[model samples]
Target chain A: MLEVFGRRPYLVLLVMALLLAPVPFLQLNDYIVHVLTLFLIFAVFATGWNITLGLLGLKTLGHHAFFAIGAYASALVSHYFGVSPWITMWLGALIAAVAGIIIGFPILRIRSMPHVAIVTLAFAEIVRLVFANLKDITRGELGFWGIPPFNPIGIGDTAIRFGLGNAAGSFALAAVLFVGVHLILLLLLRGRCGLTFLAIRDAEAAAESLGVRLAAWKLFAFGISAAVVGLSGAVYAHYLMILTPTSVAGPEMLISLLAMIIVGGVGRFFGPIYGALLLTATSELLRDFGDYRMLLYGALIIVFVFIAPAGIAGLKPRLGRKPAEATKPVEAV
Target chain B: MSSTQFIELVLNGLITGSIYALVGSGIALVYGTTRVLNFAHGELMMLAGYGVLLFSVTLGWPVLLAALATILLVMLLGAIIQRVTIAPLMKREDWAFNVVAVTIGLSIFLQSAAQLIWGEQFQGVPYFFSGVAVIGDVRMPWQRIAILLVALAVMGLCALVLFRTRLGRIIRATAQDAEAALAVGIPSGLVHTAVFSISAALAGTGAILLSPLVTVSPWMGASYLLKGFAVVILGGLGSFGGAVAAGFLLGLIESFSVSFVSSEWSNVVAFVFLIAVIWVRPEGLFAGRGA
Candidate 1:
């Protein structure tokens, strides 16, 4: 039954997923590729969120702040200073990481679930409003268009024009980001570092008592997550060659992240890809319905949360398979 | 700012805070009974606001009728939400936590549905007054005074019903401990529905009151919902009077910030207050009391 990978069923599923997904991306239409591109981008984002939200079990309803931080930082640098988009993306991540520290310092101070989520929500909204109104820097809600083209993945300055290969290159970049984040997460979550994060998730005071520095680690998780999200935002901006507050702000960013996380199952390394695919794909297909599609999509997630609290990936375990009962810190409440 | 402007700003802050209090009370009530944050509670209020707005503007009904109808309808909806979503969650104790995601999802559903139904147009709902009131040199709007006065009245009534009436005692008993209330023959199931219904009704009241002052849009409830969270955290969760006070405190800070700082900084005041409360007092100012 164990074919060749010699791993568990889910692990095999992960291997197969990576092996099979490229088939569709390489063959799909432009629209499908666009959505797949979005899905892969969310894969990186949700994975970033998953490290803290899924693995560490933190609930952040305001992740858009970090995403925006990355977008704005990169966009500003590329637009004003004529810096290469590639260099600016990393800058965005670093700036976003700093913003994450600012948010985490105060957010981690909160004890309860609702309090933390609400505070984070307010924090993100305030930042978004500021971005929308800051006409000089962000260009306000009017947005900044004509971003520099993404330098294709290659050695030297033989820079390939972005979107030139009719969706292949974009999807390739997304796939690379996805794989990079996925591998990073897999490595981190399997080691002593992961266990420490687990301990902190389980019992903060106990983790502190056990000599694990709570603030430093939590800040680390926040910063890393923010950095990844920033990278996704930067990629999104440069790829689309357009950026707007509405595009990056509010629940759209979080919903996609949350949906991917929820659909994929929390705490599983490969869970985010499933979440990204299902939520992103379904919403994309429904967008043609004009308005109510998002409403219906939102309603579907509510139904899913109530019905499949463990999410699609966690479903098998719920049916007597004994899923990892690793201490899930942030209960939905 | 001038002395008159300063006094008016404070007064305006108090008024805005009062509206925040009523909505905050609704959120706190649901949170108190269920211990789950109902993100849809804002959407419920939003729908209720639109209900009144539509009745008054489109159907040409009296404001009172529209307001009452909206409250009752939303209350019914709340009872159904309790029966369907909240009740079933009691089975799997962990499912209660899922309310966070579910309610957020529900809020999104409501917002988008309202947008699809009413479009994104910011529609006006006329106030129940004729014009602005002139307080000597400083001119004050009657809608602002009415909003504050009604908020105070509603808070008073909520206090009276939650503490004074026999049903109020039962509600209080349930809020304290559901099992103990059940042992005393209080129907906990009915209490859940009742509490949810009351919460929705309060939201409806707040929405109806707010609809006239602020233009009704699909996303109007988003800020109110966030502010309500701030008020509950600042005032002390489940402490009705504390919610009342903190709601005004938020408004006062906001108005003053808008006057002194830029309007851009106004939201910063709310966000800072939220972070401050959660940082300073995780349990809020008066969290555990029946009040």
Candidate 2:
């Protein structure tokens, strides 16, 4: 399985994407389709976070900041400025990438994992507090509602609508963006960019010795990851047509991302995707459990770490592959 | 603006700073000794809050006795957590990120479990000390003053132990070089667990002191946890002394800033200060100091 994935990763992703593409149109409950869409959104988010965290060995616990930045930027711009969600979404990603780079400048200088984690977490808190306090603009936890959805697209005689009334179009849109993001990640990681990240993660000093600009490469990864997270956030905002600072920028968002990557198998290319799918389903199933939902998720994270530190991806037997690589913990500097 | 107000603010800042010191130093101590940033350190404080509530409020134990019992219980919990969750991970060659992740998981689990057991309603504890002390134009509650004095005493005691005790020597040696410590027949793993317990005791103390002022709730630890982390970074990661000083510095910063800015923006100001500090001194302000 590892060999096949290693050799033809795109083929596997394409097959998976193809298999899931029909779900929205399968006439299933709209709620189920909505949940699947959420899974894709989170998968995008987890994958984005993995670039900085898993690949580059940056122990960031604040990727949700980017998500919130994207969501709020897109929502605010589209809702207040009359801009289309389509345009604002990309703009939000750009904004988030810039924020990422700016934050990265200070953060990348710190070598300690705990320091990085604290700094990033503090930054996210700052962001959350700012959004929460900006009552005039964000409405201050009453939640920003009535945000416009993605404008309907017309093709020939048919019109593809968005909003809750039409889940298929939204799911289709999410799927397209999901595949596109993955393809971009695949291309980037399969090339020199991935090698540089690998070098940085595996041996920072060695990579730095070899003339790899550590800060620049890290900023690059951080920026791209932030952009992808922002994009997902933008889509989520438009899909849900509501926004709350806590819902997007809170530590809960960060924990969810962490759970996904950890459960999926950190450092593996498709780990977050599998983790997101499993957790999303689990989350929906545990919805009836109400307050116990997060408790269970938390317990699941610990149990998985204890029982399967390699995550779901690591559960499979990878013949001839380096077991050490699968189990290797993120190096703390 | 007025001298009296300024004095009151300073007193308040110091009182708040004392708690910050407790929380921050706990985090710094754990990180310094174990190199595992315990993300769930706040949960220890949270558990202590619930513990005090259980023993003092529900069971009708005396406040001091309940507080003492809570701290001990939390210390025991810290040891258990370190042994069960962290020790195994640390045995692995690359356990840094895994330990951090596991603590995060543990934090969430503890928080949610607390909510499940206690419900979401905020439960207030009656202040053990009553009455106010009038000094010049400033009036301070005896309870608040007690928080300051007790916190100072607790931290001072911790300092004494860390600097003067045999266990302290063993822990510091392990922190400096685990292999060297092990070669000297020091049980580094046991030291790690001990350090965790000590850290939890500090956080538990903070929780007991804070419960009367702030209502006990499941998510009570979250904000203070962030502030505590900020204090750690500001002080320098793993430097207990630096954490103490930084904690006070942060508390004062927040207290003073709240006067000029809105209360909500004080957090932003405090965190911005942290980021600026990180930018200038990534190794922390006291990076070279030994554990």
Candidate 3:
């Protein structure tokens, strides 16, 4: 199984996708489909997060700012102007990208690593506070409701609707988005820009000496990542038909995203997807444990950091190498 | 606002600012010596608040005794956490990321555990000192004045320890260069543990002081954690005196914003100021030795 997966990776991905495609039609309960749909959405969200965190080596606790921006933008446009969500989603992404650039430019220019994390966190808090206080627009803590769903795509008599109002439709939309993002990320990873990002992450000084524009590339990564996350947020708002500060820009969202990437495998192509699926599933299964879910997630992080800092995807390389070689310390960038 | 109102706001800001400095200095001290940002710093404070509640409110101990005992307990927990989670990952190349992840994990663990044990209800202990003091046109609560006085006293003690003593010298050496400190027979590991414990103790003290001002909840640490970082950053990372100065500055900023603008904008203004400060002077306002 490992050999086949290693030799023809696409085959494994295809099989996985094919298996998941029929999940909605399997006559499973609505709760199951709902969870799966959430899994898919977060899979996309986490994947987007990986672009900045794993590949670009940016420590951001503020991606939720972009998520909230996309959510509010989509919701507001649809509600105030009666625009279709399909169009407003892109607008949301664009606005988020701009906001990302605005924020990323200053902090990325001055701060590095851990400082970036705190600054971004502060930025996210600022965004949340602004949204919460802007009662006229965001309705304060009461939140905005009755958001219109994305218009369905279909021929005259055979319309195919999609959104949270219909569980299957939500699943379908999320699945398609997950695949699209996955493909885009895969393609990018195979390109020069992706390699440059990895080089920057591994050794910024060396990459800079090699003529790579560190600031530009970092900002680019930030913008693209924010855009993708914003798109997910836009969809999330429309699907849930409600937008709130807690739902969009809360620490819980940030923690869950961090958990997904850490557990799945940082910098690995399938890490976020795997992490999202496994962690989300674990959380769902542990629903019986009530509030212990967060505790479990926290414990999982601590355990992973100590026992397997490389995460599940990183296990393969450890297994493949000799013990002595594997144990040799690598210099931290 | 009138002159009395202005004086009142400034006084209140100083009280809050002193608390921020007290907490921020602890964080700055730990980072100075260990190079590890304890994201769980606020969680330690929250734990200390709960500790106070348990001792004084539930067990009916004296407030002073409960406060002292809780600080000591949290200090021990901080040292243990450093030993168990942070110490192992210290030698790794990816120390920054690993330390951060571990602390965040520790934070979540503590928060949930607190919730499980203490339940979700917000709890508050009775004020250790009550009544108002009037000075000229200004009226101030004695508890608020106590917060400022205690915070200043602790900070002064911290400064004295860091500047005047042998242990202070060793901690300073470790903060400057760990390898050099170790070569000179200073156990850097022990110093790290000491710093962690001291930091937690400071946060615990702040938590106890703050318990009467705000309801104690598992999630109370979240906001304080951010504000603490803002203070540390504005003061300068690993700079003791810088954190103190920045703490008061941030307090005034927040207090004035709350008074002049909407109360909601106070936090937003602090963060915005933090961002601006970082962008303009990332080294911080005071830029202490070795910063």
State TM-scores per candidate. 0.91, 0.96, 0.95
Off by over 4 Å in 3: A1-12, A317-333
Whose lDDT is greatest here?
2
DockQ, per-model, please? 0.60, 0.66, 0.71
Clashes of 2: 0
TM-score of chain B of each: 0.95, 0.97, 0.97
lDDT values, one for every candidate: 0.76, 0.88, 0.85
Angstrom error at residue A178, model 3: 0.7
Error of 2 at A73 (Å): 0.4
Worst 10 residues of 2 chain B by lDDT: B282-291
TM-score of chain A of each: 0.86, 0.94, 0.91
lDDT by residue for model 1 (B1-291), tens: 788988898888998888788888888887777676788888887888888887888999887788788889999998988787767777665564477777777778888888988889998888777688888677887887888888788778888888889988888888889999999999988988898998888888888888877789988887688888888888777666778778888899899888667887788777877787677777776654663
lDDT of 3 at A1: 18
TM-score attained by model 3? 0.95
DockQ of 2: 0.66
What's model 1's lDDT at A143? 80
Model 3's CAPRI class?
medium
Model 1 spans with C-alpha error above 4 angstroms: A1-28, A152-159, A163-166, A203-209, A316-333, B285-288
A132-175 in candidate 3: lDDT tens per residue?
99999889889898899888888788766776758887888888
| Reference-based lDDT, residue A280, model 1 | 80
